[model samples]
Target: MDHKGTIVMQKYELGRLLGQGSFAKVYHARCVETGQSVAIKVVDKAKVRKAGIMDHIEREISVMRRVRHPNVVHLYEVMATKSKIYFVMEYARGGELFRKVEANGRLPEDVGRKYFVQLIDAVEFCHGRGVCHRDLKPENILLDEDGGIKVSDFGLSGVAECRGADGLLHTTCGTPAYVAPEIIGRSGYDGAGVDVWSCGVVLFVLLAGYLPFHDTNVMEMYRKISRGEYRFPSWFSPKLKKLISRMLDPNPSSRISIAKIKGSSWFKAGKEGEPVKVTSDGDEARRLLKMNAFDIISLSDGLDLSKLFETESCLDKGCRIMSRKPVAVIVSRLERGARAAKMRVSKKDGGLIELESRDGVLAIEAEISVVTPVLHLVEVRRRYGEAAEYEKVLNEVIRPRLVDKAPSSLLRHQHSLSPSSGARL
Candidate 1:
């Protein structure tokens, strides 16, 4: 009904505008067919385009699709049209983790420990799947009605092989106070280690109601992070201090891993009932079945797609293609479609077809893998380029062919569409 069009309205009954960020707004919505309450994030493609952060958006989508854990927020579906991108995500009724910390100042040790355990479980699951969440903070964590944790926001996640010669994730991003020493050093930081560091900071804040490293000066903050300089408050249990110290170690190589952390006294003490698994059915399951992590990273250049997909978990890198098309047939059709779009195409091992921008300034790649005798999965990625242009090419040129070649039984086309309740905020 509004200028944004009725595309989102056809499927969802938008309730109220929940919240707004620079490029997107969250709204409470109910599925027209199922009447299920969902948080729909309507991202303004124009705003994202202007800001050149479409890749970040794509990365968030890709990362969320690959992960399925009780502690992680579930991404139900992604729909996009000409104007906006709609992310149908699970509604966390209890709101942001930051709010709880703000109200309580400091949580009870047991409560903080419980949240930390849930966080660890989610982070551990992600790492095992070869995905690293670069940003971990109270603001990014959410709570559900049952007071369970739901880690959200993956705009800064690192998707790749868990361990490779590629060394560290060189990206310098994340909230400064929660960022790791290695990430601040920027000499290339291990994805898992930096993530652990952030988690450590999160744990500290959950228990202490303050950052372990603080400074009015940015330089001082960086210096503190680099030195891993932070004193545990006297109120902290010795066990807690020891565990946090190990997680926040300045030397990433020597930093405590999730496995060791799990075995630690503090972590073990905080353990409780298992995480609550949100039900995935119908469209959610189907979309997840065909979801691939590498597809989202294709816009970046020179990244090794093969290594990332080589993991043992079939569900990790590639989504099952619900079509009957053979791998070769699918690759041929995609290559043909890409060539027609004036993009350069090159065949690679492992059913990969690499694409180069008309001028060879950017690179993108796609692959089709046979997961079972009848089920196949198609995955795409961007090697590296301008985020805005890559998004355009992906949506305008590549996505159509992907949908066209995909079995109609498996994919549905829709316009793009987040979160909250009550009157418009």
Candidate 2:
């Protein structure tokens, strides 16, 4: 309302219009109390109700609340009156990642790798929390002041509960260029698999400065996607080509997973020599897992609006085990077990232990956190490599060594968020 004369909300002073869509408009705003900049998405309740998309709004809110990661956009809070709903979110000063690609025909390999790494990390985190972003494109990825990624636009996201009895997500939703081949078949598809396909497209666009599949005719472009037709430019490295090829595989089951992507030589090349902090103190590790007020609110069913629309599922893909052993004892056992399994073991900061195969085809990370005075949680996740190989190692080597069995609980972590992209393709 500073210059446009639009009536501003009591908590925020609306500034310039950032963007808009069919039923919502996003505006730059500042908190009246803290003066912190934020993006406020103003939605017309009547319009969404008329369009019968109240479910979409509710789902978006639910998914955002569940996912809190650094590379993804954050939803600060939601406020609603009789006619409007406002989504207060983080303000990304660097604007849309699409604009960067639009201005620069192609990005340097290092720059593209940097963004791709962040993108994969964030996407993997969402998948771990049982959420899949159905729409992933440069337009939906924003850049923060430090030029890091902040993935936005969750209106098309699907949670685990959205899957049918066939164990596949049925809804066909995504941009034509980025849509997976299975989605085009009108058959059920795994939500995670489709997201991986879109990520491959994004990586291709980032490096080549153009879509892998393109045609003036929309149907033709989709046909290209369905046929798995795409070519690499002359400048693409052999390693990059190999990785992308696996990612773009037409067969969803054969397509490379986020784990394998992390283990790829090209991906690891950028991460080599990065310092990782390691801690053996149980008290310190527990302090790191401590929750804040917002986290408490996110975990509360009474405060979640999505519950009104649908029952929330407790499905999580991450693997966790409880142990009564001391931090040092657990770390020692993990190192011994990893070495026995023919893996190269290394310690990283934050009580993380990294295990990698000799051929560099598989990598797994184990993190230790003190859950209580007597209980410690060891969360094991595949950073990169084949899923089968990871499972084999976990079952044969790591799990046998850890003691004290208890039901696995959710891991609490806080992540940054980005502005909402009101527009949709």
Candidate 3:
């Protein structure tokens, strides 16, 4: 129950607060029906909106939906009311991995390797699905009841759709201590490469009980990171040293890949020697991506079309255009426009289509949803590149092909429709 003494959604019994941030709080909760423990991340909608971080929440949801692995924290479902959004997730009773390391100092080689292998397995699964957890650090990694790894916190994650025309991620966001050197340089960087670099830093911390690049001054630490200036402890085994060296290579191109890391002698020592295979249910994942009635209502501001279509403070975040044409016709027109503009178009599940420029300057994702039998709402959002470039593409390609006119009252009445009533593609 909450402070009001009412169960959350009549489903979860909220417990003590576990953690909090500027806009969100995590609570320990139990299912009223099953008595199963779970973590509920309660996000204040007003605060998030005021901070203009709704995009981060949306991206986190998208990334979590795409990834499912034993070592990754699971998102059971999302719930929202007028004031708050709740993320019901798996509860890791063992708590943050950082706590364990902090209390016990450096872990034994075998123990550290076990956790690292699990971390890599989970990371590999995410990368396979084109999701990169930009912030990979000890605190973000949780531990299950059995002390196994459960990676969490994906607010900074990026997906392949976010790559620019250059086929690289441009955002430089991560903890300074664990940030990749290339990201510090402010040049375009591969998502997977930056993740690998952070993983290397994590490994060093696990074995050495200290950051590889550290200095009293922040600038000095960054210089050390840029130079890849770090030394292994004398106690580190030859194989471990070699593997860490390759992983911490200053050159992103030469940095060890996940597959190569798995094949390394140190990684396979005292173990089964075979790489773990992580697989996901594609059909189920796609199904989960579909917006239910509740989700639609939550995202669309209780079916208020005006609020949904209103210009955002930042135009690069997204925009909605209503179309009178059929879904098939809209898609056809979009593809034609993309081709004419020398952009590549790829269709995805749930009426999502991706457009990427040949010059690698911009990438956008457009999702079409049925607002009514005769009306469709197409949401176009930039995944990468400058707002000006995205706007140019929107004007030259998307707007001409998809925008029919301003949205009508029909959308405002959509609150009465069920998921099966019409609001699906």
Candidate 4:
């Protein structure tokens, strides 16, 4: 309410468009009453419903509500209306840590060590809270005005409840370059160990200004990650190299734990096991302290999420299943195979080909994405009337036609509709 007695519909004063994603847009904003700076994430409910990822969004909110560490981004409140959902969060004025790495090429040893400590501390905090940041990368880390670390974007995060009977997460998620070997193995992996591996990769990037696992080939990259076959630069110290080796070990059991990392001589050198001291913003503190638990009921009041559970037209409509064949061969085989199967060809663009079954019972989509000279990924999907029909088409009609001499290891490991949801065939 302002002095004029008229009602103000907008709660925060939106400044600039910070960033935009497929379903949401982030903006720089200021609290109307307190005049404090904040970042507001405005999500389109319609898009969320259409994409069928409302649960992922809710999980993100739930996990963020439980985290209150200095290195983790502070999620203040969640407000919603009929169509839009808003998340008020602490604003990071300094932008993503990626920008810093890009501008400077590589950071000094001391600087890399500093950022590594913060990242580890943040991961430790999240794991302690029964949360795992599945997607850990430089772009997900934000820097405050004082150049301090703040882990953001829990959209791909998983919590304790997601753990399987074996007490490991089976989801294959995260950026390819940073993902652990265990994740690419298609076997269940320990969340904590996975985060540690990603953090180790981030540390390497900070110091070397490039990914440790490098190849024009995705399968080759996975092979390198699986074998723990990355080399440290000449500039890296012996102690740091030793620590990184332990962290990047292919065996999760052999990988260095966060507790061990904290106790390591290299990690404790300058700080002597003392954690970085970051002061909380006054407004942020007040907001967080006032609201402890996430009011999911109130947040979702009057909201209908039934559409989110229904199978809407496939969102993002593609998968990245690895293949070793040349692009020309892969494309030709796909087209010829679709024709041989008597499907009505609809369109072809670059490596993508679309076809519909003659009887109109199913729609087939296929595409090829080249990761390296020798390694490529074939994306395939079939949309049908029911789950059974979809599987029938996949196993009986589609699978046999697309078989290639490419390494079986490619498709055997990484093929899922949505990694976060743990979708598999």
Candidate 5:
């Protein structure tokens, strides 16, 4: 939208303005060679420089250049003139996913199952290549006339594989409602784990036509998220609840693995390669996104996660006073030699954690529930910098339960939960 030198698409006739963003404007255009419809995204170099996204824009082009999948959006070609950069992409005939959700109400199980598989397959491909789609939601997923899902909007997408100083990711990026707790806690987290968490949220939205974690007040939502609290209506099946719980685990370490997600009962039960609805005419698979309720708010609007650095969670400091919220815990993990280990230290009581390292890999299930305490207890003390002293209550009342368990048994302790329960802020 902001540019100087003009390179008019004199060959390809430009039509309606499809969309606009901070970086570019997209228009529906017809290719002179084929007379076929295509969407053109024109970006200005000066705007890229002003936003300090020149690197991101290049990374996006490089990433898009390598991706070759039917489920993912295809970039036809790129052209750069002095004033503008061009991205010509295949036009998805169908409309937004959010519009279909709002108009159709809660989709039938079969309908959701079809779309879920498509979305997962797209995500699986990205993960296979060491990429993490930081943003995954209804708005970014497009539908073709045939009801196929086309994953678009790669502006926020980038590789999360840590091959440098820390082998863990700590960027406080992603939409708040769908973000993983490890991200919220400012502890380094596995990129794959956080992506799965977001996918889980998207899955919930597809089936229920509502967000599981919804709050109007920003801080209020943060408080609810901190507590790992969310509610699903009684009418939803128990199986759905189980899946959502695993996806929304308060601890990223505990979130369900993508492998488990693909093999889950919900996904496995659905028909293969089908649309949302199957009719003789095949019109029900995907509803058109044009003029839908979802269009009222462009889904990509909040996707530019660069704004997160403005939060107190900026990575420059060892500890950040996050949004005036009481700093309660410091959670961290180490992965080496096939072992992914985590330790949460009492914030009030600081010292080396004498944790028993697992002989093999960290049990994925335990990582979610148990490791949270390791981080929080230490954070509570670190952020407060207070006189509150921690007591070794576990040894006095809890050591007896270790007799038969793999890890020291915590049932022997008086507290209903292992050290993980009642983790303080």
Candidate 6:
């Protein structure tokens, strides 16, 4: 299916074949001008038409564009010539799971746990936005140079809410080994359920270094999946063993949902590796500790506090001078760019300094035991004194956009570490 146009193949400068799929051939390509490496998946139109896979290919690209997650591949550009469709994607330096797992023999339990949680988190984001990745397998997950897994290949993915009641994925897609029993049995099943089931299988593979239900006979694999029988390695934690059991449940209705999956004891068990340290300094402790409504007399940070405080004697006949409580500005994460939005209080450390609005109106990513003092309603009221209105405004106004990106008055700062979540407020 070769169609030649004025478009130059040398422009792409294909280096080597990255991998070959049933429908497409991917290559490591470089831009002649910029010298940037990219993965280009070329799908032959004739082959696509022969297999009647145009719809799947269309949906695959559509799904990939809609999903924006830290652990998902980013598609840079797509182009089509007379005979070939090209998908240009970010090049990941890390190799395939086939080689990665082969090198490690088996992944460590903690390592498996981290990847599993990230996988679920990405899926949860998809479900939240009404999409479901119907096919999830080790081969479909690509890793970056840092060993971070980026889920790819959305060709078999479908919208979870739009799926028919028959739940059979309507397409009979996904790998044979990772297919949920419900899917293989032709029972209508939710798309989300099947994905979770596959995740369970992946977990099993990670922990035991083998597939839970494998047989040369397809019928035997189905029987095991239908019966939902699987065993744990003796070395596996009880929590993990129990989690996989629930997730691989034969009944879709009984299968765990991704949102609730995180709250599961097994998922929470891994978090015990560290006590959360939310602060980097004593200033953070004192700033988070004292929060009260102040009589905020101005919208500008440069408003003369001394001058404003000196003018409070009009209501008091005897008092010549009146004192106003200073506004306690505590900066916290603003949703606009989804960065750690904060109010920069001081530049003493030669770094970005932000203060949390004293009135707990913003947020603290802390548990009750550590953040109890600020959250105590009675204490908040008592500490608020006569400045309750300041608390109301802090919650309603000033604290919302402390670090927003577009059209924000907050300090100009963007996170280099986690830049994906930033959005305009």
TM-score winner, 2 or 6: 2
Count of backbone clashes for each model?
Answer: 27, 10, 2, 2, 20, 13
List per-prediction Cα lDDT, in the order shown: 0.71, 0.77, 0.78, 0.72, 0.55, 0.57
lDDT, candidate 1, 1-425, per-residue tens = 23232337378777777677888888888888888888889888778878877667765776786676779998876666556677889999999999999999999999999899889989988876457898899999999999999999888888752222343467788899988877777677778888899999999999999999999998899899999888888899999999999998988889999889999988887664655445433434454455443232221222222222121222223322234566667777777777776888887643357787787666666755443354555666555555566567667776665553533422331001011111110
TM-score of each model, paired residue for residue: 0.68, 0.70, 0.72, 0.65, 0.62, 0.62
Model 5: residues with Cα > 4 Å off, grouped in runs? 1-11, 160-164, 271-425
Model 6: lowest-lDDT 10 consecutive positions: 314-323
Residue 221 in candidate 5 has what lDDT?
80
Worst 10 residues of 3 by lDDT: 302-311
Off by over 4 Å in 1: 1-7, 161-165, 272-425
Against the correct fold, how does model 4 do in TM-score? 0.65
Better of 1 and 6 by lDDT: 1
**At residue 64, what lDDT does model 2 achieve?**
82
lDDT of 5 by residue, 1-425 (tens): 33322324444566678778888898877877678888778787778868877656655654564344578887775555545667778888786776788888777777787887888877877765446777788888888889988888877664532222344666677888877778788877777787788888788887778887779997778777767788886667888788778878887766788789877787777745545543221231122112122111111111111221111221111110111112222122211211222322221111222232233211110011111212111111111111121112122211222112332222122222111121110
- Residue 239 error for model 2, in Å? 1.1
lDDT value for model 5: 0.55
Query: Model 3: how far is 380 from its true place, Å?
Result: 11
Error of 3 at 14 (Å): 1.1
- lDDT per residue for candidate 4 within 21-88, as digits (tens), equals 99998888887888898998878888997897887877676568656677889987666665667778
Strongest candidate by TM-score: 3
Runs of candidate 3 exceeding 4 Å displacement: 1-6, 270-425
Query: Taking the tens digit of each residue's C-alpha lDDT, what string does model 6 give over 139-176?
Result: 87888889888888888887532344332346577787
Q: TM-score of the candidate numbered 2? A: 0.70
Query: What ranges in model 4 sit over 4 Å off?
Result: 1-9, 273-425
TM accuracy, model 5: 0.62
Give candidate 2 regions above 4 Å deviation: 1-9, 277-295, 304-425
